[model samples]
Structures are given as structure tokens and as C-alpha cells.
Target: MTAAGGGAAGEVDEGPLDEIDRLDAAAYEAFMSEVYDALGGRGRDLPARELHGGLVEARGAVHRAALTAEDVATVLDGSLVEAIESVGRLQTQLGAVGFTLAREAAVRGLHRDVALSLTDWLRVRCPWLSTQEAAQITEVVKACDSPVTAQIGDAVRDGTVPLHRAALVARTMSRLEGSLDVDQREAYAEIATRAAGRRDLADKDLARVCHQLVEDLLHEAAPGERERAAQELRSVTTRRVGPGLTRVTIDAPDGVAATINGVLTSSLAAPAPVKDEQGQVLEPDTRSPAQRRFDALATTIQRGVGRPGAPPSTARATVLLMIPFDPAGGVPSGPATTAAGDYVAPRQAAEVACSADVTPVWLSADGAPLALGRDARYATPAQWKALAVRDGGCSFPGCSALPQWCDTHHLDHWARGGHTDVARMALLCGRHHTHVHQHDLTATVSGGTVTWHV
Candidate 1:
């Protein structure tokens, strides 16, 4: 019922402190030492149970005694460092065992998708490991199989990467799965792993640095696609947050975005004071910036609604796409390029092709307008409204931007041979649209659910 190493009660000797630290380190080391003997030493073919049970019992007794120690503070302070170091080592070993089981499960062939296989076990019994942690550890274990990342993976196993950095490297490796070629992916994974292990990048910079590396590597891997248009979609929307409040978000191209932001700033900024009848200046208006902006918006809406030739029911909107075509039949052959000059991936393009907000138009290969009537090139406003109701928001996986804040993206480029029909377009918000084309990401849309490859 007391710290095994704490000397008799109220004895303020440094000897007890030293003893606690020593015992804590020794306990964890002893457990790991036994594991190495079983797995790394001779006669490693069979599983060793009794040795592990004995080690666990020994560690448990020490832990219990330390927890009840009269000098509990001293015991806890010294033991915490050792406890963390011990868990890192233990995680590495257990994760490796799980990796082996997953790899060998099929008997005839090895499976590389090993990390997810252990999530169920961790979710139920491992109180300390979160779902994310379980997945991260497994990912690090999987990284060991890659030749490029093997060295870094070794660092994780040896506790060199520690806790946070190990998670960073593991998540980066998972993200790079579809974004890079085999060699490039492996090489950067190693660099990420090594940098993380060495503490070269701070926790805040780890993800950003990894992201830049991924972007650079993607560009390096597919330099050919750089010149092709990457889709550029922008939108704006509002959401009702409460009984009397709403949230508005806007995403637009750089120039237009600046103008919009400028308007908001001017509206919200402090106003100049008015002069009194005697030409003396009065006190400046001191309302909150938010209140001013709200008033300005309400005024603007009133004026806009009363403008001549500006009808609330009808608006002219334009979408320009630079699509490729089959020269022989004037048919579309490739994904459409938005006026923003971004390319759409084929699968995502197909998703749009099945939506209700696009209409097809026929054009000559010689750049002349064909005899196709207006109905062939235009979708009714109602069709677009229906499309919004169906999609609800951005169609890309994990995106939650509302439908009103999305642009109708054409699957096949209109410039090539695609029609403007409702069945050939889908909605994409500005950010997700940019990301999709930036990495040339692959996504499959089925019943409105998107499956992103990387």
C-alpha cells in the first residue's frame, strides 16, 4: 500500500526519489527485455505466453504499489516519463504482431491493407488508444513494408519518433497513397518519417510540411497534367443558425472576391461623423462593426430589389467550359475544363453528367454555332433548383458546403462537344473544387456519395 521505493514515511531523503526513478525505468525495461527474448532470441517459432503473463503480473504489482505510495506525487512525477516511454515501445511491438497476423491471414498471399484489421480490437479493449490512434499505429506498422519508408518505420519501433510524430508520419503516409507513384511516394514517406523521428518539424508545422511535400510530389509525379485546366468553381450561400440569425459564406475568384471583401469592410468600418448646423463636428457614430454591416446589407438589398430591369425571378448566369471533343463526330471525349482552367476527373464528371442542372448543346467542329435550338442549350431555372434540392451541398466526399454555395460544374467541357443539359452537371464548392483539380484527385460518385482515392 505504499511506493516500493519511497523510504519510510516523512523521510525527505533524495534516496527515495532516485530509487523511484530507477525502479520505474527498470520495470518497463524488464518487460521489454522479456519480449525481445521471446521474439528476437532463439526458439522464436512458437508463441510465448507464460513469459508475457509473468512480465504483466510483475509490472502490475509495481504499478499498484507506486500508486498507493505515501509520496504519491514523487512517484507519479518520476513514473510518468517512464510510463510513456514504455507504452511507445509496447505499442510498436503489439502493432507489429498485429501487422504480421494481418499479412499472413490469407496463408497463400500477403495483404498490405493491414491497419484497419486491428481497429475493432483497439476500439473494445484498449482504453488508452483512440480509434484514430489505433489506426495510426497500424499505419506506421504498414509503412515498414515499404522499402523507402523502412528506416523511418524502424524509428517508430525503437521509440525514436515518440507519440505525436509517429502519428503525423503515419497519417501522411496514408494520405499519399493515391497521390504519388510508388517510388516517389515511398521516398517522401521515408523523408516524412525521418524528419518526424528527428523532431526536425514542430507539431504545428508537421501537417503543413507534409501537405506541401504531397503537393510538390504530386506535381513531380504528373508534370504532364500541370498545363491542363484544373477546375475552378466558386459559390456563395447562407445558412440559418438560429431563430433570428444566419451565416453567410462566399467563395469567388481572386479579383471578384477582393471586391466582395472590400464592400463588406467598407460597410462594417467606422463611419465619418456628421457636422452640426453651426458647422461644428458631432461625435462619431460608435455602433459595432457587425451592426453597421448588417444595416448596410439591408439597405443594399432594398435598393437592389427596386432597381429597374432587375427581376427577382430571372437572372442571367454564364458557365464556360473548355472541353475536348472527337473531331470526327463532334462528340465529347474528355472531362470538361471550367473557365477557371481546371480539369475534372472522369468519374466525377460522370457524376455531374447524371445530375439535373445541365443541358447539352451541339456545336460544329469549325467553331460555328450549329442549328440546335435554344432548348438544346439551356436548362430551366427549376431544373437547377431541383439539382440543389437533390445534392443539398457539395458532392465531393467529406465536403459540407451548402448547395447554394456551389457552382454547377459541367462534366464534359462545353467547348468540346458536351451539351448544357441538366444530366451533365453537378455542384462543387470553391475549396473542394480547387483541391480536386489541384492533385488531379480521383473520386467515384454513387448515389451522391463520393469515394476519394487519396
Candidate 2:
């Protein structure tokens, strides 16, 4: 039959694909019924070996049919939401077909020897698939090993839900293996399947719901069992990826989770952008909440590291940066890099250095002390406090940088007769400080407000 209810030998389906994709409910139901039949049928009583070849051909046909879908520059008929639903249906169908093939191949013991492992066979047959993708299929096969989960296997094959959601069901059931009785787990599997069937269920939400179900099941368990399960759930692991980057994972309980959330929320409470005296953004903060959360973690770690209340052995991690100062003046000639290869602005490094215990080392060209670790250019503690209180934050009019982030700037370039006194001081954050010196911004201090005459 033709696409337009005509006889065969006519043209294939044509027109705006976007329009064709949103066929009425009756037509869609009929088309899905035909697809269901193909998914269930084994072609013409083929021998077991040839059946694999038939399965490959069927997969290719489905792939090609999906590829025929045309992307429209603009929606002409149905809404984009419906188009998205159609894509989901197609993907679920494809996943079901692939999982079924894996289960069949494994069950039939096709080349199930050590020399040509299942992984090897999958790599050869599904050449485009990654190792992880093949491993997921292996997991699905193992999950279906039980007669109890037979319904989940069937639902997955018939595209009642997606592979990821099915995988969640499988994994959740596995976690309950030694904990719950077989009957309890089988009952939970039904909940997983029903939840997975929802069109709007995202993978995260699916995992969340499955996890809650497990927790609910455990709620009725003996106190000792509950405590053991809670103990087993706690974990903290860190894997170093690079010179200074580490990925940390935590399975924190309610109290710890709340503590982390509170710290991060406080970290993000202030306005984001660092501004210049001209009310221009000195640094734009475009980081998302997730990214900001990591930054907050870093900030919290830095703040707590080797502090007063820490263990006696945690005296401090000594950090000494030998920043090159321009001989003509004390201005930093370039960037300052930490021992761990983290490049930081001179002003920002100075802020960290302000709090850290420092034994400054200065060497002349002849390896002599430039001045016994004392530079006349360095501001006194009193001077720093006066600057902080007077300027409030970055002296830039609209900048909301906290005092901790602000650096005391010389109203007159220190290279050109600026004194290290309160009258000669202004406060600016790292970016604005760089801008002021680099662009030679004109400046003045009157009362508590420091004005910049660019």
C-alpha cells in the first residue's frame, strides 16, 4: 500500500515532512500496529543462524525509514512538542529492538566462548557502538535472567518505555536484591515499569522515583537492617584528573546534604559581575548554578584549609610565589602562578597572600636579598583596613565586590609618587585594578567615595 492510500508502484510519501509526521490519531495507531507486528515476527521460518542476518536487515530497514524524516525549518502543521514526542517513540522502538537482539543472541549461545566473547561479537556486529553501549546491553541481558523481571523485559521489547528508564528499573531492583524478599522486589518492578511508561518521565526523575520507592520499602524493615543499609550508603571518593583538578563524589545523608546546600547558597548570595568605576562589567559571571556550585566548593575548601580550628598537624600548606617585580617600579611584570600551576592575577594572589603566613623571598640578579623580605611598597595592616572601610568594596561605583575581594589601589600610580597612605589609597577588585593600571584611569579620593576620571 502507498502512503496516500494508493496502490503500490506509486511515488513514496512526499510533502513537508513536518506535516506528514503529525498524522491523525487513527493513522498513527494503524502505522504503530504494523510496526508492532514486524517487531514480533521472525521472517519466513529462517534457520537460527540466518535469523541474525534477518535481524540485521530489519534493523537497517527501520534506521532508513527513520532517516527519511525531513527536518522543517519552521513548523507547518503540528507543534514542536508533538514532533519531540514522535522522536521519543522512534528512539524507544529502536532501543527495544536492539535489546531484544542482545537477549536472543545471548540466550541462543551464539559464539558464547571466551576467545570470542559477547563484547567482541557486539564490537564486530555493532561496529559504530561504543564499549559502554555494548556493556549496557549486557546489563539488560543479565537483568532479564530472572523469571520475576520477565514483564520488564517484555515491556522493553515492545517499547512500552525507553532503555534508560528500563535500565533504572533493572538497577533499582538489583540494589534491593539481598535486602528485599523476592516477592517485594517483583512488586517494586511493577512500580518501576508503570513509572517508566510515563511520556514525561525524565531519567533523573525516574531514578529519583525508583530511589524513593526503595527508601519507602526499607522504611518498614527492622531497625538493625535499616541502620546497616544507611551505613553501606555512606561514601566519599576523590579521583585526581590533572595537576590541580579532582572529581569528588559523595553519598552524603540528610544533614551533610543540607550543610552543603546551605554553604553553596550563601556563596551565591552576592551580585555576580565585578564592575569598574565606569559602571562597566570588569568581569562577567556567566556560570550556571551547577558550575557555581563547584566554585563554591572550591571557595569553601580554600577558606577552611589549615585554619585555626584545624588539627595541629594541619599548621598550613606553605605557598610562596616568586612573582617578578618590574625593576623600574614594584609593579608585577606578569602573572603569578601557584606551585600547582594555577595562574592567578597579581592582585588576587595578594588577597590570598594577605591571610596566608608568608616569609617573602626576594633575590637580586646576583642572588642577594633585594631588601630582606620587606618592600616599602607593601601597605601596612592599618592602611588596608582604612582602605576597606572607606572604599566599602571595589571603588568602582556600581561594583559589589566584597571587601575580601577588593585590592587597595594607589590613586596616583605608585610608580609616579603614589604614597602607601590612606589619602593615596582606593579599593578595586582584581579585574578593575588591572583595568585601572592598564588603561591609565585618572582617579581621586574625596570623603569615602573614590572617583575615577577615565
Candidate 3:
């Protein structure tokens, strides 16, 4: 055929771009057919990665040609349910690929192109899908062709697992191999599901167990090797030390001998005491006793301060301490005495008594009590109840996590200006709390809505 435009008279009218688009559409159809056939029969026949890659490429072409800013805007403005259904139908017919994969590819470009956030997009377009489900679907598609991804899709289709659980399985499986036979894979998959169900199990523990299962299947090691691996695994699983009760001793730099109990071994440090102008001990710096204890523990851990190379006999005592605020702003109570001279207050004494990791002892400055180990001032049951009521759930916006699943988060931060009052605190799930601190997402509560300023 003769070339048409931008050429001699004999040239054909069609452009290369038009031809390429036509061919891409046809190729995409064929790819879809193959994927459908593979899923209908044994899904193992096709390489998931190759199929996913093709689908993604096809989606790019279709998205460029068929979807428009106007269409997206109209859809977002109109009924989200209708828009999602329409999109789902269009994506479903795009070829014979799995519905999960097709929907993922269709939305992939939309996430970047659409003005509204993808989460919002899903709400408008696929109102039938829960946020958790949408997140899981996205996670699986992003991890295409992996055994875990496949498993997640399978679970969704079978309705045996929730989206979150499926996502966890996919993540765990991605670290493993598809070479595992059906029986072995099923075993590990079941284990993964069970682990996901148990909220108390650490994610690392789940991954480790799944990894061990895969290793057992792939390595086929001798009994000795297996035993060694088991031992190492056990070591990792078991806590190196227990909480609540332990003994630790701090060797003062001056060797004057001060003992405290319920002291955190990790928080023992030998920072030089600040002295006054007259060679008398000035007020210890403003660091909280808790902060000092943590610093001491960190120092011991890093420098191996008091821990001897050889083992010792008797365990050290635990000491507890607390700071009490009087109704007036004046120096409330020192370690040595209250107005009664029977040792500061019962609350402070209790703190000293309960500091279990070491024997209970009070640290005094010139025979005046300074600090005692005790429970945090604000962790009362009533305060926690108020926090739960105010926050409703995990206070992170868009997160509907339950109360039991959350931890109290200080609004201004206790280390900063945040107080222990309920109004200045909110509940956040462990994951979101970690994300807040780790990713530096600024979370603040105003008018009862927790806003995240990333």
C-alpha cells in the first residue's frame, strides 16, 4: 500500500501510529486469550511474570487511547459504583486474564494520572471493594507472577482468606520459590494463614517459619544440618532475656557505691556528674530519670560496661523511682522526706519497691531522695479508657483498625510538649505508629480528626 500523508501521492493515508495501535490492541486480545486459557486449565503453564508484563504493556496502550481526563473526572464526580463497575467490565473484557490482574493493570495508570488519590479513586470506582481488599489487590498485582501473589489471588477467589491475610501470604511467598510441590506449598501456606490470624505473632516470626519450610523442601540437608538450623531458629524465637524481673548492677565511675533496683541494665551510663561552682553537686541535668535509665542501658549495651566476661553469683537488686508533682509549682517532694519525714510519698515508695529488675533502692543526693523506679504516671486504666473513647479506633485517618489493635500515641509527644491528658493523646495501631515515626509523617489531632501531614 502507498504511504498516505507527509509523502508522495502513492503513499498510503494510514500513519504508523495508527497501525501500531491496531496491532497492539490485537496482540493484547491474543495475550488475554492465552491467559484465560491458562487460568481455566492449569495456571502453572504460563509464566505469571511474562503474562503480567504483557498485560501491563497492553494496559498502558489502552489507557493512553481510551481513558481520558474528562472521562475520569466525570466518573469521579458521578456515582463511584457505576464508574468502577464500568471500568471493571471494560477491564474484564480486555482479554481472558484473571480479574484481579486485569483490574490492577487498569488502575495502575489511573493511580498516577487521576487527580484524586488512588484510594479515593477506588472508593469512587469500586465501592464494592473494602479498603483493605483494595490494598491487598494492589499489593498482589505489584508483586505479580510470584507464588505468593498467585496464592493471594486464589484465596480471594476461594473466599477462604481475608485480603490482609492474603497480602501477608503473598509477601511471605515472594521470599520463597514456586518450585515447591503442591503439598509442601500448601503446608507453608496454611502455616502462613494461621500466623496471620494470630495478631500476637511477629511478622518476622511468620516469615522465618515460612522460610524454614521452603528451606526444608529445597535444601534437602543432612539430619545434622537440619538440627543445627532448628537450633538457630529456636534461638531466634526465644527471648534472650525476660521482662518484669531481672537483676542488674551499675558500677559508679567514682566507686562510691550507689544501688538501685528495677533499674534497666540497658540504661546504665557513667556520664560525669555536673558539679556546682563551689565543687558541690549541682542539680542533675533536666533529663528525666526514665531517660537517664535508658541512656545507661544503651551505654552498657554498646560498651559492655558492667557485664564481666566471667559469670557472677548473686543477681543484683532492682530499684524503682518516680517524680511527683504537687498542686503548687514548688519543689514538690525530694527523695529524703515529705512534710512527714517518712520518705517522700507512698507513691514514690511504691515505685522504688516495684522496680524489679534490680533490688528496690532509692538514690539520694545528700541523703535527700532524688528518683525512684515506678510505672509511668499516665498509663492508668481510666486514661486508657478515655483515650479509646476519644480516638474511636486507630486515630489515623482512613485507618479503621480496632481499639484493641491500637496503642496510645501522644499528640505533641511526651518527649516534646505533649501531656498525659486524654485530649492530647490518640490511639494508633502499631503499624501506623511505626509509619508515623519512621516516615516522619506529621500526625496531629485537631477538632477530633487526626490529620496526617506527610
Q: Give the CA lDDT, 0 to 100, for residue 167 in model 3.
A: 68
| Steric overlap count per candidate | 24, 0, 37
Task: Name the candidate that leads on lDDT.
Answer: 2
**Highest TM-score against the true fold, candidate:** 2
Where's the lowest-lDDT run of ten residues in candidate 3?
A: 309-318
Assess candidate 3 and give its lDDT. 0.52
| Residue 414, model 3: Cα distance from true site in angstroms | 1.7
lDDT by residue (tens digit), candidate 1, 1-454: 3444676765554664466476667796786578778777654534556547756886786567455445655656668788776665665555544444433442323221221134434444455766666666556656666676666556655656654566667666665555556787677777776677655567767767776775575456444442221112244557579999888865464566676667667734447567899977788777777777766666666786666431211234344443344566334556655557677654344333323333223234554434322343334566566557766766664445677667655445444355664566566675555555444454444674445566
| Candidate 2 residue 118 C-alpha distance from true site, Å | 4.3
Local distance difference test values of all predictions, in order: 0.55, 0.66, 0.52
- Candidates arranged by lDDT, highest first: 2, 1, 3
Candidate 2, 82-129: lDDT as tens digits: 867777787788788788888998888773431234655677678887
Name the lDDT value of residue 261 in candidate 1. Answer: 60
Supply candidate 2's per-residue lDDT for 139: 61
- Candidate 1 has its poorest 10 consecutive residues by lDDT at 107-116
Question: In terms of TM-score, how similar is model 1 to the real structure?
Answer: 0.35
